[model samples]
Target: MARLSHTSLWMFMVFLFSSYCTAKTVTYDFNVTWVTANPDGLKERKVIGVNNQWPLPVIEVNRGDQLVVNMHNGLGDKNASIHFHGMYQNGTNEMDGPVMVTQCPVPPGATFTYNFTVNQNGTYWYHCHADYCYPDGYRQALIVHDNKSYFADQYEEEFTVTVSDWYHELIEGIAPDFLSVYNPTGAEPIPQSFLFNDTLNSNLKVKPNTTYLIRLINIGAFVAQYFYIEGHNFTIVEVDGVYTEPTEAEILYIAIAQRYAILLTTKNTTDTNYPIVTIADSVLLDKIPSDLKLNQTNWLEYNAEAPHPQADITVEVASDLNPHDDMTLIPHDHMPLLPDPDYTITLTVNMENLDNGASYALLNNISYTPAKVPTIFSVLSSGSLATNSLVYGEFTHPLVLNHNDVVEVILNNNDGGSHPFHLHGHTFQLLDRAPSYGPTFYDYKDGSPVSYDAFNHTAFPQYPMRRDTFVLPPQGYFVIRFVADNPGVWMFHCHIDWHLSQGLGLLFIESPQQMQERLTIPQNHLDVCRVGGIPTEGNAAANSVDYLDLKGQNAQVGWLPAGFTSGGIVALVFSVVSAVMGVAFLVVYGLSDLKFKGKGGGVVEGSQGEGAGKEVGSTTVREAYRDNGDEVR
Candidate 1:
């Protein structure tokens, strides 16, 4: 009997420890509003910001923690949504936050809550998904710390460094000119300046002889930037939220939305301040205006008593770094070998001028348009993944995948410009790349297609590099593979802001049946679509002239007159009912608490409320509702 008692005690302790290791909730309240600021101290412009502060806010959390952000959109007349870039958002696809794909934009003067658990740890960021909003200022760093990281002990302190292309004109003002038919060259609006952490001449204080980890994030919209610090070398430890084998370099090339964590050791006894430089790559400068400055500088000062000398330093750019080489970024951890793919998707990316004379980026000859209804909503409501009349052809390219199925994607870039492709909700293995050089192009033009079978697929290291974003060289082909384990709708697209706006994107619908079972979208998310003046179909407004009837029949875009759809009415009614029920519950709970605390009454131990038998702590009421599987559909 004593032995059995000891066994029970051990089992009980194990259960308690396991439960404690589960995720806990971390909540943040964000007020999205407009602010006027000069990020470069040269031009004052109206910008969208969180809490009326420029550069927004940084979110830091440990791995296995639930992140809950309550966003109150106060941007007068503008809609907004925050997308947690590089987050897997496993099983919580409703909170993925790509407008019109996962959920609609949070309407102005409205509140929407995003909740998802962090399963992996590294550097990441959050940005506004609304068109041109992020470029204006709605972006911030999101860092997830991993105590068990391979390089955790290598650095004593950490800092976040953000580099972006700065524009003097408001993105709203530039959009019309950029999309105008008269501008047939498709030249992207060039940035006037560059910003390091929202400033031109930022300073980084460092301790001599100490090792510091700097998380470098390229949040620019258009061009790729090359970063280097004079008199120092970087040991790259992480890339795009995935840890990699340490590789040393004097300069690093960071594409749009890509991140790198590098270890920088201060000079042992030097009191000198080092210059940190950022310059736009010459290859990407073909479309940029010739007069715009391409380089920006900051200072990294080491703590010392004597004043440092004021001298400029010139360093060689890391032009020899090849993005196509997979050997450069070996994974630090052991990665399980991917099984033979169940599906192979070949996507050809190109640009073509439509009949209306507007240039659009296309994937597989189809320009992507945002769906009228959220793809997740459509999947759950219709109980199918088929491309129906409601889900327009150009709006969605559905690659329906089963759970745990391996998917290989071959991205064939036919355009003359490089594109940094980003895949939402998953990190893929980089298998190989074939550049469109002389011999490769010559064979293809001679009616001999370049075969991928000739490429050595096993040349990658034992644990290959896994990242969410990679640069697809102009007129090149890239191969990537990922397991379709995360359910719901995901977007695979170019990170170039202008190209993405021009419809360079596609959708992957992974395990819709599983998504229907796991996802419970909140009522507030559904209510965003019911807001006035928001388009449920296509990327344009209700009466916008940009809508095209591609079938050549000259038919109208929507069946009903604007704002008279039955679906909108049903959504409004449902939102109203949800609001009423929530209010009633709160009132009843408040009254019951008052009764319990009255002078003549005795408190009842079990009389809290319905579904309140267990103790509630940091979890909010809405989160509790979601936990109970109270879906809005």
Candidate 2:
């Protein structure tokens, strides 16, 4: 080597120092971009990919690998962000990936990078930060495998399966109460379809008899999905990225926010027509009819009356069940519940009178109203995308749980419409549904069950299915229980497109320590938390246009329109009217007494004087005067 010059030596030293002078870190990047164009021209769509693949091809790394992803905003005009559904990222708030909560929308052509270390192994997903009512725009799967020591047999092959639903509508700034008007015939704001890996008929073919690790994920906007191979059965060995006891799925029904790893073995190598896959419709077996009756022939409006009479669908399985075929394939594993539930909350998905002179959906009977927040400068403000038409309160609740606490949430859909309820972070076991009561639970004095479809009914069906999610049959109640083992903010919400937009959601926190460890901000990262955490239903904009100001002056108001109930307003009107009537009675009685007294002329005796003192007014005084008159005269 040539002799080094002093200047060259210093420059070399500087380069060395610069290369080694950094803290241990990594950066992650992503972008929310539209699909350029679809077969049908829907606007402002979201698509995902590192090079434009649906799941933005997996970011594979071993333990201790530094990670960095820079999220870019490429959606034409729609605002979007990314949420890593289940990631324990430490020391990274901005990268936490909540839209408008942790970070602002990656404005068109802007980029924000997320940096973290590969701390754990599991199958997780990231999607649009907007509510589940939105379609899977700019979403993908992120899988971190264990280092060599923890890796399972990988000599064969690896595959990924993503199951999700697609919507044909733009979800931004949609009102939450849209579900209330969900008549089957009514025009849907969002048309929905199912997609696998962002396309239909996505196939992965390989050698027969070879074991392939299939990672199945559901990134649907809402609702759990059932994925089945036309021919082969799968062994579900992992859930939410964690290895669990291997269970067999004759048919695979995956819940929202859930992931599963299955070992798929194709039967024959020579078979050219292998089922890459086929999607089954996830619609509820019980659908609401267009002509569902609201009133009976007798016209008695009963609260317990089912919104629609029952209709049935054929529950088809792949093969005819031999009498000896074990239907016991549906596992009955008791969830690992902690001690008794810490606190019990009963919330009903229902409809109550709204300020707009219409009946609206409710969570625990409270509809969406705006909260009283000072930072909010506008009256139409309900969420960040505040509007005059939107209700303030969406039907979401706040629950607190310990890391070890067990939670039993009973989602009773009393509304006439059906909904798919989804929980974040954990897959829950469905416990039971309260039996369908006729009209009222105890309305029958004669004790005859009310008759809509009297013939095809069970007093109460014992349906305790082990599922992470289930459909809410119309006019039905679904009780579910899950362990609060995950330690971050979790959201429970209706997957119905319009209902979620209207505000049908709530959040719960588990373990103060875990909460503090995971979420850096004291406030929750949802639309409800930004404005001081008040119930949205209390907003003034949601009040009716015809509402009168009775704050100061006493006024009697009456004859509320159909679909309206004002307990406080009714009480106020009744109080004012009742007081006026009381005063009128006193005045009339006083006037009559005065006339009777005037006619008497202050003299009294017996019947000879004033008809035997059978006086209408002052009878006692007249009798006293008559008896004393003799003595005084």
Candidate 3:
């Protein structure tokens, strides 16, 4: 009888503990609109805001809680959608936002809700995923608190630091220059200033001898930044929502859409404060203006009375500062390298002019183009043909995957610029990359690209790192692997907003049959599509009768005629006409001498020379067109 009473007491204690830790639902109602704010103190411009406020609210939730964000697009002039970056939306793919990838963009005055279970925990962010929308300040940090973290007991408190690039003009004004022939090289617009936590020179008051967890996120649309703190080093514990084994680092290179969590223990003395420096990567700029400040300084205040000195300049350029290679970090779970992939997909990144003569990024030969129907809807409504990649449209670059198959992707860059590639719905195991961060990172910048030789390359690590976003070296290659366990359409794209605009992206239709069986999109999402005049049924072109027939599907801008763009063609035509007209004038002048000589009955010696001059002019005109033709062709 006594033993039975002890067992009942133990069971009662377990039940009380579980009841206390029960997860609750977190809900937020957002009214998205336009507001004005000057974060960098350089200029005030229109920025996207939530609830009539500019610095959008940071979303906070604990792991295992339910997150529901009821978003109403109050911006009468623009469309918007929120993408919870780095979240693996597992079975809820319809809520994975990317304009037309998962759901339609919420139209003006329309309401849409993103409701999902918070199963993962770490530092993350939520931002507008629609084209040219997030850059206008529709981003905020989304933190998922994990009481069960290995390092949770190490820190007394936590802080969120956001590094971003600020622009004086809105995305609408900047889009014309980036997507037009006037800026022929597709040079990304230079930001007016760099921002630290949505403002400038802000101080974080810290108590000496206290350990704090600092979450670093580059919430910018274009430029990445180098982050460091003077007189202190921190241990990195998490990256892109994945808890990694604690590693020590003094400097970190944070690209756009990337996040890192570090444990920073303050010094015992409160005699002085330290400067936290953020340097914009200058290599991304086409032209850095003299007045445009690239380096920004914030403070870690140990004492309010102590002077906060400016940071000491250490490097000649941002590239000279070598950051720790993130590919080497091991995950806390220590998930081993996935076995030889059941499938492999290989492609190259090329920056070339399309038929419009505007520069575009391409995977293989196709640039990502949107479809009339959201891809997730297509998968749900396509019946048994959902697994067919053809239904997703040619320019969407659809690749189908079977359920539970291990997939490998090889990405080779032919361009000289680096790209931070992000895959939605999964954290891929980064197996191998060439020309890693260090002195030899840029050795292939001007030379032939080093492609990943599957059979001849370095051996894969026993325990490879995993992250949703990974940086691809310029003119180098990277190989990653992941299991296609999720059943939905996921987009794999470059996180650089400009690159995505130029069509540097693709779609993966994973286990579409399962999606058709298990997925049911909300009716409100369908209503928004109707309001936007977007069809939600059938294939990409909206042919519900035949899923395989994609006749009217959206396609990318056609290829330029080998070395010649439409702009070049027009210029050539105008030059040719101008040359012909000039030749005609010379010929007319050459005959002037003969006409006068016949009328006056007087011989002119220069008539022969004038005739020769006409011949020379004719030859010059023909040669000019010929030379231009050669160059254009």
Candidate 4:
């Protein structure tokens, strides 16, 4: 090989770039910074923006296109990263972003790149996965175009509709108060307003006699939404990036991180436009504000001149709406349920306060805590010992799985609320769920909770529906199964950002031996850890020499006393400490003699001794007040 001249090299590089672009290499240079946005028209607040654009940019790519995002952390005060939700990053698991799980949070002025191939196609999304990062307008719809879609030729056009709950304040400002001891029962912070397509009173202009593929995604932080169109019913085609057999549905209950694509044929006449309705799931809220608009209205505009009236909600509340039962759906591919699970992970979802008086969500008895080193680095650095869960630390809730094993997850909801759980790498089959959709679906909380018994349950579906995210009903149980074919560190956690912050999640270290063979941590990723003062090697405790030692790993806050609530414990401890210190300070002050301003020969040298005292209000070293109207206390 020989070096080319400057002019020749430049021309050659241009040719290569042109060829790459032609082959569908989609690239985005995102400058992650803060900007102001007012989606609800109520208040303008600071939000995370890409390329200085709020309501962030929607990323579109053809199936199999190599997507490359060169991200720079321009948010000077915050750390950030992006997670391509519903994407199965097969051989490229490092690109799956969840701070402390796959990679370190990109520090201020640092750079990180997300380069991976989009293999599957359907409704998906991308959002900042760093703790408290995405709620502030850092998320957007991600569509993968498939020329060979089953309904590709049946529909004339397609549109993406995102439903979300909006807040007037930044997440950082809300976390301290939301997670404080005063907020027991782990009540989630209620959003200020619900949005349609990131705005209010939006319209999806459509023509009569046209069938459009509408993509619905609930990119919300806390509350789930019920979606429907007045006087219209759509045929459901896909859910969470998995295509399902066409099933008619009049209403849908979409939880956070869930996506649904439906084929909706417009009415033959354009005489009237229909109202698209979205209602917040009030069951998830502890207290709904009187002015917070729960029912949001958009439009399926048949004629721009026609009046678009408000939707007539048939139900009194969101719970009264009967949405389709996802477990009863059949996969378009007809993929049957997986064989009996080779490994079964049975855990309960619990909400309780730790010794610190702050509430935390736990799986089994342990709440999730981020390790000192990223979990991905620990897998790549560990040798044969990667198969051993001991190296991953205790608080991380590490579950080392075998390669290509059939894994079954049985989630028992011990808490009194609903949780939408999502898995990072694979979509599992919805095997069985107790208390199916009907009048009693949302009424599960009124009675004792039902737990799934392996020996007893209804028959599993023949061709079970596959989805990346699913909702666990209130105090009800759900059983799901998936094959562990992908080799990487995938997280199994609740999609609620607030609950996740309280530690309601765990890591699935699948096929560690295979991960060690196929994956290599990128140099740029390593540099990010170094810049952030994070260790890239060692166990979760950052003990490199001895992988089994987890002595210093991060752990959840200690437990409160047996018979006291979080508030009671905090107040007791605070009062006791204050009284003891108050008495000690009183004794010391009482022993000292007072210096009167009239009898001042000079100031006493020390408060403990009676000596010559200086004059009061003097500007000398012994004076109690400064000459600039400042007291020395």
Question: In terms of lDDT, which candidate is strongest?
Answer: 3
lDDT of 4 by residue, 1-633 (tens): 999999999999998886567557899999999999888899999999988988888999987789999999999999999999999999998999999999999999999999998888999999999989888888999999887888889899999999998889899977876776545556677889999988999999999999999999999898999899998899999999888889999989899999999999999998999999999989888887789989988999999999989988767878887889888889999997789899999989988888766789999988999999999999988788899999998988999899999999999987788889999999999998766664567677877788999888999988989999988888899999999999999999999999999999999999998898998778999999999999998999999899988898898988876898756755664464456445545644554555433355766434535332322212332232121112232
Q: Write the per-residue lDDT of candidate 3 for residues 1-633, one digit (tens) a residue.
A: 445588898999987777457778899999998999999877888999999998999999998889999999999999899999988998899999898889998999999999999888999999999989998999999999998899989999999999998888888877865776444566787788888899998998999999999999999998989999999999999989988999999889999999999999999999999999999988878777889888888999999899999999788888888887888899999999999999999989998877775788999988999988888888988888887788899999999999999999999999888899999999999899988876667778889988999889888888898999988888999999999999988999999999999999999999999998888888888899999999898899989999999999999998887778545754655576577767667765756555335557986555464454565455545543432112121
**CA RMSD of each candidate after superposition:** 20.9, 21.6, 7.8, 9.7
Clashing pairs in 3: none
Deviation (Å) of 107 in candidate 4: 0.6
The estimated TM-scores of all candidates read 0.78, 0.56, 0.88, 0.87
Error of 4 at 252 (Å): 0.5
Clashes (backbone N, CA, C under 3 Å), per candidate, total 2, 38, 0, 9
Candidate 1 structure quality by residue, lDDT tens digits, 278-300: 87755565444556666777778
Residue 621 displacement (Å), model 1 = 59
lDDT for every model? 0.73, 0.47, 0.88, 0.87
Q: Write the per-residue lDDT of candidate 2 for residues 556-586, one digit (tens) a residue.
A: 1122466445454344434544564455456
**Ranking, TM-score, top scorer first:** 3, 4, 1, 2
Name the TM-score of candidate 4. Answer: 0.87
